[model samples]
Target: MDLNSSSPQTIPVVSTFSSPFDQSPPVKDPNSASTRKPISLWPGMYHSPVTTALWEARSKIFEGLLDPPKDAPPQSELLTKTPSQSRTTILYNFSSDYILREQYRDPWNEVRIGKLLEDLDALAGTISVKHCSDDDSTTRPLLLVTASVDKIVLKKPISVDIDLKIVGAVIWVGRSSIEIQLDVIQPAKEESDDSEPVALTANFIFVARDSKTGKAAPVNRLSPETELEKFLFEEAEGRSNLRKRKRVGDRKEFENGEVNQLEALLAEGRIFCDMPALADRDSILLKDTCLENSLICQPQQRNIHGRIFGGFLMHRAFELAFSTAYTFAGLVPCFLEVDHVDFLRPVDVGDFLRFKSCVLYTELENPDQPLINVEVAAHVTRPEIRSSEVSNTFYFTFTLRPEAKATRNGFKIRKVVPATEEEARRILDRMDADA
Candidate 1:
């Protein structure tokens, strides 16, 4: 092979380009160093923490529930408050999700109202408050009496549905009165009819983080849903399209009829609603109660140079476990014990950690008790992705007591088989080992 091109006979030498007298290579354009292209940037506005949370709940409910978009709440109910000043702010703060118009409407087709009351039954003890107002001012000292939406008005003209997240709330507070103002985008209708289309308004209820303490208070009801509630179909009997037993008592015709009910039920390949699209009151899927927990830090949680706090991470991990256990057990599931919370390595802030739990085993340890066993896990992504080290794991055991057992009986149970992947198989293996 002539692969030895460097051999003296095959190669040629150029003396002109020799070292000593070699002039420097010509300079390339400094600014035109390389081909230029426009920088790519994600478009549109960025959502604030509040907007993110608001949209999270909104998207969650709408994804798989019947939530109406045209009803409005009554104003009288919107202004209602709890006797306690602490709850007043919480309830008022959570009462709006901006406004949701009809799919093809604007400004006023529906309104959203809310009550965090469903979850508040548990947080009374944790939330510090005092009853200052008289009974005449409002109804009770605890539960909020406000409606989710405060108004609604439908017009002959229609437009697109408007959904905006409510964030950055300012509660105008007095001794007994509080007016909460939330950041929202109010959509306007194109054509203004003399009838004045003004129905769609809405709100959201959430656990407000106390500004001074930075702690989330007990459950508080806010957001008036009267607007949407009024529009929901309360009675579907006569309103449904279920066939009305045509040609009753015709024996000869009945033989040939064979009751085309099945045929009527099966049209156009899609499952038809027997009635107009109806909203279910339970479709607003905000959790009624969340477990008591916080973020913590410790030695094993140290990230870089032992600068990370493990207690802080543990607090968050506990919260994840608590939330999982609470959602599944519902009501007030006790945080009995956090077992073998191994702090393998230091964890620092900014490392994304995931805490999860599922009903591993529910055994009636006693004839009169529902001693449920929850398998909890808290793990962090490899903090130093380059190092491939310092991942943390935390585990726990939670108990569902009788007082709140009734409430959590309906926590969602996932329906899936074991995964076939290596990591998934490891999880399965770990679970089996624990078993």
Candidate 2:
């Protein structure tokens, strides 16, 4: 069971690993020399021609998302164009490079939410390849990815030679998705601090593909021009119609007396915030509030189409849900949003994964912020029959740092209970179907 164990914990050998819902007989790892290959949908977005001539030598940093019409655009709207000749805003900045600030320093140099989700997944794949090459800046080059990330708050703690910036734009476009919006600012570290907040914001989505049939293609269309880009194009068209009503079943599934109405609202103490009468039910038991990690899926953590890289499994489930919400809220949480992640399968290259995390609920929202949701999951092992598999499932959200008598008034944390009653009606049907 030594699938190249790099140790972050690792223990599941469960007999000899192999069942993420069986592909029937495929677990032989005589110390795997990496050959289980078959699921690598080539997303090598560009493995050099000097990285496609340094992306056509940054065609003017994608002329603000392709304003390319100095003539030629007519073979029947050549893959549809408009949105004022393709939306805009892209800005970047980044500074602190010395092998990226010594690989995210730790003897105190800051910058590590797993190197800020691998630099916000390479700045949301360079704003989805400059908004899918501003709708074909002369064709052939799509292969985008990261098809889901709708949230990523972070709001502070970047340090290490500061700079950053980022920005991005494309609000929502669909017909092969796009979304974008990200933010990530930095600046004001004090020129007598004239405000510049927003240490991160995120909303990504990206899809495009088809660089020789990986499929889904077409893009370009977010027109909105101010009034805050039409209120972020109507909040990215209501989160792209709530991600097409949770992808087509038009949403609605939490029944079975939704955890008997969350155990009659936690046996009548009617929880909805202000809790601390030493919040009970054996102190929020989901197996006594969890947090795990394990490891062994390296190869420099795969990706560029080799799997296991959704921002390095979202930086190992946001550093184990910020170490189980900093050991159940003794403070230091921050990073809010990533309210969903569903990769669901693909973590191979010597699998062993694991992750786990917990605390599935907590809120206060104001009264000195408090939120915390977490969840995590992942799994993989399979050791013959000791079983494992699940693969992925994230759902983050945090917020704590308030200080002054520890967050002024609301947060004696510790609340996620669900340990059956169908995991308490699937955590009250996923927090009432995700709020």
Candidate 3:
């Protein structure tokens, strides 16, 4: 069946009621399948049986890593796969009777969106591996790593009491890159005629690399059968093009010393520096709102390929961004959307990782719900060499809690002002991207 057919395809939903870590003790018989322990899935609100099976099947990649084969098949021998072939669904039963609701509920009785982001990354990885896997499992598996997250938009607030499901599949594929699209949906209640509403949509891009050589590896071509599938493929292609154009434009702008609206902002910044007392009392300097955290990556946080997991980085970055927004807004901050995330370099297990976050800007167009943009840059520090390199950059948007405006009298967020030329340039760059 076509994944994007007009009629909804029947997806095999795997419930998250049983904990993957709660399996029974291994049997005495060596030949019995129960004697073998199942590959443990990451602890989370949702888990797909299909993904688990895939992981178990590909577990031999670890052995191959130690002793790699001499010859490998060429890219031309790979099979062409359809979107439906890699489609998967994971169900989160958060109804009134289910015990799983407590795990996902926040203090405000709403679903925790940060945890969901982590799971989305995991699910996207599963889809990518499923699309790139071949029939011959004896050979080594490709090392699929997350290249970037194009965008994740929140369409509606997710309630903790409703049943939810996440469906995802490969929407487009290139020479060595694959784009996966995921939809988080709230299923309709029993006896209701309403349709399932999508609460969030996410697009993730993954790149395949040879396990032994650590070079680019080819992936199966995606064949879109239905009109919807074709349209999505084309849309992803256009987004890829836009990203390339943006990079080129940014380089040219910097080379030509073009600062369109930044000149005025620079002048304003200089004036603020010259006369500190004349600045607006209701505003705060962007530099003063920074928060930083540092830690050494551990083996427990590594992914299947023995590298730091991308989801772990995202989870930590998001927590810091939330804290930055909360401090800047002086109230509880709610996650609005993840604008974009770029994985520039892979972080190692023992790398000293530092996460620095600050409030980049704020939008007060809506007085009741002020929007705040937070940026987090992850850097790997090497004290021996006295050098540091950025491994990832994350951009997140947040807002104040809805009740904050009603509870606090004359409540307003202080405007964030840039005091340095670099800060001014950052603000202008964000504005141009939004435009």
The Cα local distance difference test for each model comes to 0.30, 0.58, 0.76
Leading candidate by TM-score: 3
Q: Model 2: what TM-score?
A: 0.34
For each candidate in turn, give its C-alpha RMSD to the true structure in angstroms. Answer: 28.9, 23.0, 4.6
Residue range 100-183, candidate 2, lDDT tens digits:
355455544566666566556655665566555644444445556677777677766666565444445566677777776656
Model 3 ranges with Cα > 4 A deviation = 1-37, 41-76, 96-99, 188-194, 254-260
TM-score for each predicted model, relative to the true structure: 0.26, 0.34, 0.86
lDDT of 3 by residue, 127-199 (tens): 7877887755356678889999999998877888876778899999989999999998874445242567788
Question: Model 2: how far is 407 from its true place, Å?
Answer: 24
Residue ranges of candidate 1 with Cα displaced over 4 Å: 1-305, 356-361, 364-367, 371-379, 382-390, 406-435
